[model samples]
Target: MAALALFGGIGLSEQKAKETLKNEALSGLLAQAIQQAQDICGSTLDKATGTLLYNAATRLKDQRRLGFLVNYIANKGVSSDLQLNASLDYIKNHPVDPIDTEDFERECGIGVVVTPEQIEEVVEATISKYRNQIMLDRYRFNMGLLMGEARNELKWADGKIIKNEVDLQVLNLLGPKTEADLEKKAKAPKQKAATETTEDKKESEVNGELHIAFERLVGAGSARGGESTNNVPPATATATAPPLMIPSVSLQPTQVSVPNFPADESKGFHTVPITSTIYIEQSDFREVTEKGYKRLTLEQSVGLRHAGYVISVQRVLRNKNGKLVELEATCRKSDMAEKPKAFIHWVSNPLMCELRLYERLFLHKSPEDPSEVPGGFLSDINPNSLVVLGDAMLDVSVRTAKPFDKFQFERVGYFSLDPDSTEQKLVFNRTVMLREDPGKI
Candidate 1:
């Protein structure tokens, strides 16, 4: 009875195992079969079911079952089909061979049976496709070999693989003209040297003309009897003097022909009549030394300020229009008795004096109060107002002058002292708006 029980147990376990296999196989087959049906009907299989079947096939390594399902789909032809029939056919025909048998081998010492002629055709097509693709997606393609891999895996014939030197020679023979065309394109064009421009030619001509004029003037002045004399002869006698036999000196102005520059109307080419009015008046003179005394009228004082100088009005005249005009006015430094001291005083009390004068005339607060005046009148002066007049007049003290120097001209305005100022002359630039409010102009 024990032996009988053992046999029955074994039978039950075997039945269970068989049932499990049957269930698994059926489940897999059903999934694949549905997908096949969908392909045949030219419609998509339910996504979840299709994924289950694909995953099962991969996990089980059941290539035969997968192949069978693919065959069923290829049998049907329709527009909405997945169009995977060719790929399926490839897998069915080229079954994976057993490693031990060595069923797969290279045809001509290479990995595939592709012929040289076929490779050449594929290479040409691939090169053309890649060139076009490069133009279309240059940035993406330049990123790396990933783009190339994608293109190659698409089964688009990439190009001939010249694994050996002999294959390269053969390819060269196939397209000899290509190399020649490349060489022709690589050659650079020859450039001609530039010729002299019109402006340069005109400058040369002007220099030549000036040289000739200078030589002629020198020769005429150096001729005999042209020496200076204190006594002046009568004009008639000088004109009638017997033809002086001055030595004949060969003086010929050299001719220099140069190209003329073309006229350009864009360069300040305009003509307009400019009319100027002048008035002259003779009047009496007067002088006053009293402090706080008005030296000139408001209009005259404004004119003096505009002139950027201290001028003494010696006379006043007016036209029929009731305008007080000044004439024969003499101007000298305000403190001419001590020129150096005056300069120092001007530098030290620049803005204060100007502001005082402005306030007295315009009935307005001192302009310096807002900008220069510190916390109070007793406060320190604005450091920016301190001018180094010593360095400023250095240029004018010497015969040679350097480049212009910009300085805060004390209280007046920012000035760019002109380098053209020599020992005999001095010039200063009044860069800021003379009036406090420019809009008033």
Candidate 2:
């Protein structure tokens, strides 16, 4: 049953490898491209992006140049489907397109990564200009204004970062939420923070749950991907509570001096600080002796994201207030000669994000079947279908994504850029998981 509907809700990646596999003409090109993409990102190219491989392989038949362009497109792609389609169309129309061609950057984004400072400057300036309006509207402000101004300045800037910076700056300007604001937010239809806080308060009237919910609402929806688990040890925020982000985070970013790595593994370590000061998700670090945990547990060494190096956690460092503010780990340099058993995705200076984790709207696969679901499809609605992660730390690579841009988050799920995204948050609708769970099947 799971296999049957695996690709059912994939809005953009609907056409999986099977589509190319059935088409012998495109299959070989996809096979070749997938090999390259796997080496680069350890995943298959989004089927939507995979079309370029056919164009590159067929149009510009030079094997070496073909390999280079394919690699570039896989690593750094054009922003939207329209642009990707345009690139594909260009390759088909033109008889040739080498690495030196002017059309590469002109048509698609065959460019460099937009640095954090450059992005920060734009975000800071734009928010300062609209400070009064943003403060007044609070989360109700049309965040797109801030995003539009920033993106106008830097089209290639990570949309994730822009939204994060905007959220951070706005929240900072607004200060803490007043009870009136929370009550008003609670009255709002989808103001996630208010709803979650309300729910937590209901679960336990204790101040601790309220405090945790406040942290979750203010914290990061967060960046990159990391190993996720259901169980975790008790952890607290940093002594300097900059932004109360999530507990599901990996370790903070570190500088790993790797003299060399496999040619295909990385172009270079694009070290972007995911956060300042260290407040790792205790989930990323568990108590020692929890065998097969595969993260930075006590005495266990794990590799850091972006930068490649292993850090063995000697002990957990807490503040005078007993807050889990830092991790004391010993760094040992290592080369990415081959894929390590596990690598941790950490954020040193991460952008704040809101991730809307969606599930099936209706409980029954065939909701319309009265025989399967009593009182019809309407009654089979899944009330807890949407879980909002308001303060998620997100990678900036996804920052400049235009609305409707689709991506498969490494281990999380396939997500679509929902129209609900605003100045306060870049809302993503979870289209589907990477694959179906056997239990659900």
Candidate 3:
């Protein structure tokens, strides 16, 4: 009867029942479309989400701009709403590079960096609570019991970070690595240098960051460039940053390009000596502050991005007339222990240069359209289209960058070497902003 109504047979159904039933062949077309959709996106909603999640994870695997997606996937649980909102947010905040790890993570509720100490405590407690079982099971035991239990308590923390702590705790209890365990580890295939993988890649699931003082409880650390003179007006505030140590002894070149990474960086990258004086932009530090400002003001800490070291400001260095010029700082290696509020990009022995930032030439998107711009297109011309920074500084990583060479300055925008440059001076033009914003420089 319902089918008859759709066939225009509610009143004529008595005579047209046979005719209405004949449309089954047409309905098969609808069925075919559904079958095609199911083939592309799994048959059930659960299967569809699983496929989506897998694709999202795999596609975003090498993408640092996206936060540790494995962590997001593992923790997203069963809430489609949660998954959708988080995914949308990450897309919205996506950058030319990684989401600004400093602010983006905090804003998206990735929460503070779970310090090595905090992780150790949680792992120890979880293990101690189940000590008898761990002793009984040994290698045969479901180690994830420790992992899952600890993860429940620290939901916002990265799994790999937590896994490292768990490994250390379990080993301390289990004592020396048996020849069998060592051989098992040795037999495992090595991954590429660019990718960081664990002895057991299945940390039940999460992957996740930096600094020079390293408290490596276990596992290898990644140290970029042996010696970089790191000056912080920072971005991601690091807490016990991912364990790393720039050898007090420098073996690699002092100034290395970040793009040239993927060499033997275990002892940490090659080093350039820390200059006693490192220049900083005026805005990185603050002399005064208002309420709720979690920055390098009133005792807030910040990290030096990529360098993996934390800078503690002993005194703010200012030039004559009280302008912030530099920082008298002590850099220490991080153990991934404490959460710094922010991290920033800094350069040491940087090259003084000039930068030209560009905005849209017109204030309105459809400047030529009379409806869009009542005034002539000339009247729609934006006055702030060009912003020139004469005091811009660049580090040696890009020293090899010749004219027309393009680079993305993290948290800022994309830039290209300008035609007008001399051996003594360099100038760059902003090719694009990291994102579309009206008044950004």
Candidate 4:
């Protein structure tokens, strides 16, 4: 009967590899049906015969029938290739019965025999052909419920066997009640009296501490550290603390060297014990203007003042015959056109020229109001003040001096390094022009 059922579902044609997979799928279902039939009949087939029939069923090209046969063989201990040549010959010779035909026709069938080993081989081949697909089906069934005709087939074959068994055991234990009713009866409400007692104890402790803190805060009022006194009286304000005394540490006297000469001593005359007649270059003379005194920015004034005391030196160069020769010396603007005697007197005093130079190079009109005059405080001076290439002459030694080098130019006030210095020529900016008034620069 199992063989018959398995063969009944085997409806596949062998043509291509894909056809073989279809055969296996059908064989699996056929095998399952045959097994279910055998179980229902309470009859067991020879294991080898069952296997042979399963093998034959799996060789069918129809996947659904092949799958049923494969499952039947699996449950029935049956091999799938049982009587394959015989079945094929039988199928070939005998005309399939219509649904109306009730009896088997035995007259026209060919009886060809097939070995059990052949059945097993066929089953293995069929399974190997569709191993991956079979696995996918198994995984799908396990993950969810089987679907389509397979689901109906399963329902008919097993009749909810697993669910029935589970329900029976549950009913035996739980008296056939609904799950919700069973759960409700199984649970018991816990007595809350012990929990309430614990909560009350905690609440009482919290209340006691809170009451104490509240009473303390209210009673203490503004008093923070110590206990408050109810009888304390407000008193009139009065000076109660004595003055704080800081001890004085006397510092030792510092002997600071004082510059003995007056800061502005243009009028003071010292006799020249030795006078050197120095050459004066006409180009070295600059016309002194009232505006020139105002033009000195703050930085130039400080730079000039810092160049130190000025001294006028002049010399008369002489030929081998002892004849007087004219020499050049730096002079201010007003003295440039004056007679040589007047130039001599002006250059003789250095402090007057130094103060005037400071006024000319450092002072300037305030930027806030151009007309407003301001002293040349170094911090306020425009940085771009000095013009290079102004005429000047110096001794041969001074001519080789580096640019911006500090020098006391005779009769030219004080000079500082200028950018014009080179191997060929040296130039200096008159840092300050001599003047009589200290406030000018």
Candidate 5:
């Protein structure tokens, strides 16, 4: 019945029915065009964005029609003549580079330097978590980078680029495996197929040997100057394994240029790196002064806290001169158990310090108390929550500390060189207490 209505079965001919259907289709296309024009009526286009749209239109080969459409859009405030023209220029002038490469050649280029710590952490974590050939290969490359070798920025035939530094952080944070576990796994033999004949098994073994040889060739070629600086032992081969046959492959000297990496000057690439031994903040200090004693802000007491004057210090470990000589001893919990009695903290350098002592921010009252309402937590604000230790001691090293430099005081909490600190009078701000439970004696 619907088909008959469309064909007008009571009076319409076949030719007329076909003509009606064609007209309907044309009307639908026109409606869609109108909708598209309305949708793009009021949008601004930048050069890059305009170029993309213009290039797509150009592919349609309707140059005259496209020119009129561009003008109409520009006049409608959706685009501009300058932007469109720039895009047109870009489309005509942009260089086309080969995305896919068939080169079986190796290219060696200098990559970023990685720290020994970063390499150790990343390798340990990767070995434990993934333990695959691809990941292990990456770890080896990263190790080379740490040892001052330029890491190979491998560009696969399909255009995929493997950037070691980009993946280093994520791999480092993964839980690391023990060296014993890693060694055990490395020595483990690859399982063989149960149904395979001896001849097939021999072929598989030969293939495996060939793969190892191929890796060595690639690794050596990729290093440019010769063997990699990654001194770590091969994870796949056993110490006593017989030498395998090297596959016959022609060597070709070639260069593959990769995108230049962004500059990161803070990685100690061109500057001396400072390693922190300890960190003490205001929260770490016990009440050397009497509780509720007048707390003066460092700003308020800068004049009184003179050089060589004792502010407050406690003997943390066994030392006659009261100095932490061993860097590793600072991190040992066992060593902390042998700490000495409270001593005077002296100012070795001219320093203005604001020591903020921790106090209960709010007081809790019993539910049955007459004055206690549910929302009374705000009213119970501890007036002594912030005690400013204006007169504080600082070591001579504080002078060299740039603004915002964080370091641990001998017995205090982690403190930062305050932004307000100056060359004439260095200022230190107590950031936090050493312990989470500040009330603990």
Candidate 6:
């Protein structure tokens, strides 16, 4: 079942992987219950018996006595569906822990297959045997649920882990319960400290069964995930205690580092960094080669800013022609560590330039198909693949760049001054982008 349903595809995204893990854990719990029921019914298990046992334990919510019911019903004259229904109705209302096999057999007018001692043994083995494993499964299930809830409320960058303030509220709430549970038994609420971060306060407010269980496990330092319980001091009833943030969680999936550039793996355009210089050959453009020149869009200039390139626009006057245009400018190290948001390398004199951005070179046969081949694949080519940014403004620093000189366009792509560039006009052709720096191309 898992092979066909769980792994139908080749690769799984982080979210998809989490969902599969959650479903597996849930199925494991249910399967464990089925095995426990079958143990008491011996080697003659049937579909009807299995369905009844599953419904009684899960849907009816009778976790305590499913084993006894199985033993009493399966070893008797209750072979008919009518008799089975009557017996199940009786078991659902009665408490099985106190009933011995002799009484159960008498009530059903049939001798029990498993003895009373054997029933006791099965009960003990299945009920408390995998308590720890059950707790761990519950933890995984709850984490998956919380992540789904948080994702709806947060603005997450693609491929980034949940880290924003709103999502942190859900993460922090993974403690045993609400913040109130952190206090020692019978203790008054602790006073909030002036130094507490805003996050510390929010975690204390959300309440749920999962949060309470999480606190219990972490507080005892027995949680399977090794989450920290020492952050907040246990509350004492007799004295005033200091307020602290809820305990920290270290879910297994959360520990792995998020990839810098996550792409649609089904396609072939893997990420490659832009380190060297590239020269744009206008002759290489599909339009210039096959047709005529096309105008660039101003929206493309706005899109570049989102990719981490700080393009500055300043009013400047041309010395020779006295043309009025915004001096388009970019700093070489705008993406460097510890740079101010306002920092940019602006030039007094602006240059008339054009930037050509390229998308995937080969056409995909279908959205699901990954092959990008030669002749036939060209028919599936994306016409809007390349974006041209003409009528652009550039800073004076670009004047120093030769025709072949390459400059990494921060988060954008690698570009070189066009060979067709002259004193009157400048052009740049994009080579390849480093990564999928979100927002726009």
Best by lDDT: 2
> What's the lDDT for candidate 4?
0.27
- Where in model 5 is the C-alpha error above 4 Å? 1-352, 358-360, 364-375, 437-441
RMSD (Å) per prediction: 45.4, 19.5, 21.9, 57.4, 33.1, 28.6
TM-score of each: 0.14, 0.38, 0.39, 0.18, 0.21, 0.24
Tens-digit lDDT string for candidate 1 (1-441)? 332232122222333223323444433453455446555644444333333333223222234646443443334321111223233334445665432212212111112233334543443344445554433332223323433443354332322232211222222222111222223333423322222211111111111000000000000000011111122110000000001011111212222111110011111111111011111111111233223222232223211110112333334445578643333333322223111100000110001001101112111144236332222222221112222222121111112324343322222333333554554444444333222322221
Tell me the lDDT of model 2 at 7.
Answer: 23
lDDT of 3 by residue, 1-441 (tens): 544433231122233333324445322322332333335544433433333332332223123422344344334331232343455456555645545655644544542344445776787789889877666555445788889999988765656667756754564455323333334342433321121111111111110111122121111111122222122111110112112222222112233222222212122233322332333333345546534333354365554444444555555555577744444445444334254544444555455567788977765567688655443455444434676776555654445457776544543455667878777767768766544321232
TM-score between candidate 3 and the true structure: 0.39
Which candidate tops TM-score? 3
* Per-residue lDDT of candidate 4, residues 1-441 (tens digit): 343334433321122222223444443454554566566434545545443443444334333333333333444322222223333344444444331111211221112233322332333343345444434332111212222222232222222332322222222222212223323333433211111001001111110000000000000000011111221111100010101111111211111111111111221212211112211222222223222121111111100011111112233334577743332222121212221111111111011011112323222334333222221133223222333332222323233345444533332334454674565544445554332211222
Better of 2 and 3 by TM-score: 3
TM-score of 6: 0.24
lDDT for each residue of candidate 5 in 26-140, tens digit (9 for 90 to 100): 2233223233443554333333333323222322122334433443343342233233443334434433432111220111111223333344344344434444542334332
Ordered from best to worst lDDT, the candidate numbers read 2, 3, 6, 5, 4, 1
Task: Name the better of 4 and 5 by lDDT.
Answer: 5
Lowest summed lDDT across 10 adjacent residues in model 4 is found at 211-220
Model 1 has an lDDT value of 0.25
